[model samples]
Target: MKANVVVIQALEAQIAELDARLLQQAKLRPEYLLLKTMPGVGEVLATIIMLETGDIDRFAEVGNFASYARCVKSAHYSNGKKKGEGNAKNGNAYLIWAFIEAANFARRFSDDAKRFFEKKKAKTNSVVATKALAHKLARASYHILKEKQPFDAKRCFA
Candidate 1:
């Protein structure tokens, strides 16, 4: 029991040390501060987003960025008939994870986000609603990164 407790404490200390180092590196990037302005995105998530989305200019449009983040639906259709599916797993998995995580937190903290999530939930299942919210966040983050501006809930949720 004592050895287990000691091991847990050592691991906790190592985690804290690594977190501090990550924060130090994140602070050096201006995009980190911009990303942190959004609801539900904290130090770690902002760092992940900033690192994963390197050079936002590479994306031609917000849709492109959202697609790259795996936040959009991947479906292939010809005319009015459903044919097949696109490569849904082609984008950054880490980004989808981060955005979905952020969406969950945002629904709890941001009123606009909560309202949007509930509305979407009413129309679809919880998982779809959550993914919809994540998609919104991904698109908003794309604008934030490209424009180097803070997040605006009014603009995002409107």
Candidate 2:
């Protein structure tokens, strides 16, 4: 068991190293560093964001990027009744995963994030709360990339 654990740890380290190399190759190390300034976005999430988004110009708008981050509602309703579940299939899986992971991390590390999450949760469920945070992060990322500026917590949360 101990040997297996050591092997697993070694493999995880190797994967992280490779991920770093890939981030460098993509010329996104700077962007990744900028993202790391966020309360919950670390190197891993930053890398995932950069890898998943690639060229910001491809996303015509922040809404498109938010959708790609898996932040859009998956269902639609009309006249106070549920219409069929909307297709939530289109998106970047990596970005979705990264945002979810960051949301989880933020819940643990940032009181502000946790409070926002809880407020959202009181109205909806846990999944919705996480997605809401992901949406905010996606929009923040878009502006940051668009203006070539750093993330501002006040503007981001607002």
Largest TM-score belongs to which candidate?
A: 1
Candidate 2 C-alpha lDDT tens digits along 93-145: 88888877888888788877888899999999998898888777778888877
Query: What would the per-residue lDDT of candidate 1 be over residues 49-156, giving only the tens digit for each residue?
Result: 989999999999999999999998788888978898988789899999999999999999999999999999999989999999999999999999999899999999
Top model by lDDT, which number? 1
CA-only RMSD, every prediction: 2.2, 2.4
Model 2 clash count equals 0
Worst 10 residues of 2 by lDDT: 23-32
- Give each model a TM-score: 0.89, 0.81
Pairs of residues at least 3 apart in sequence or in different chains that clash in candidate 2: none
lDDT of 1 at 31: 76
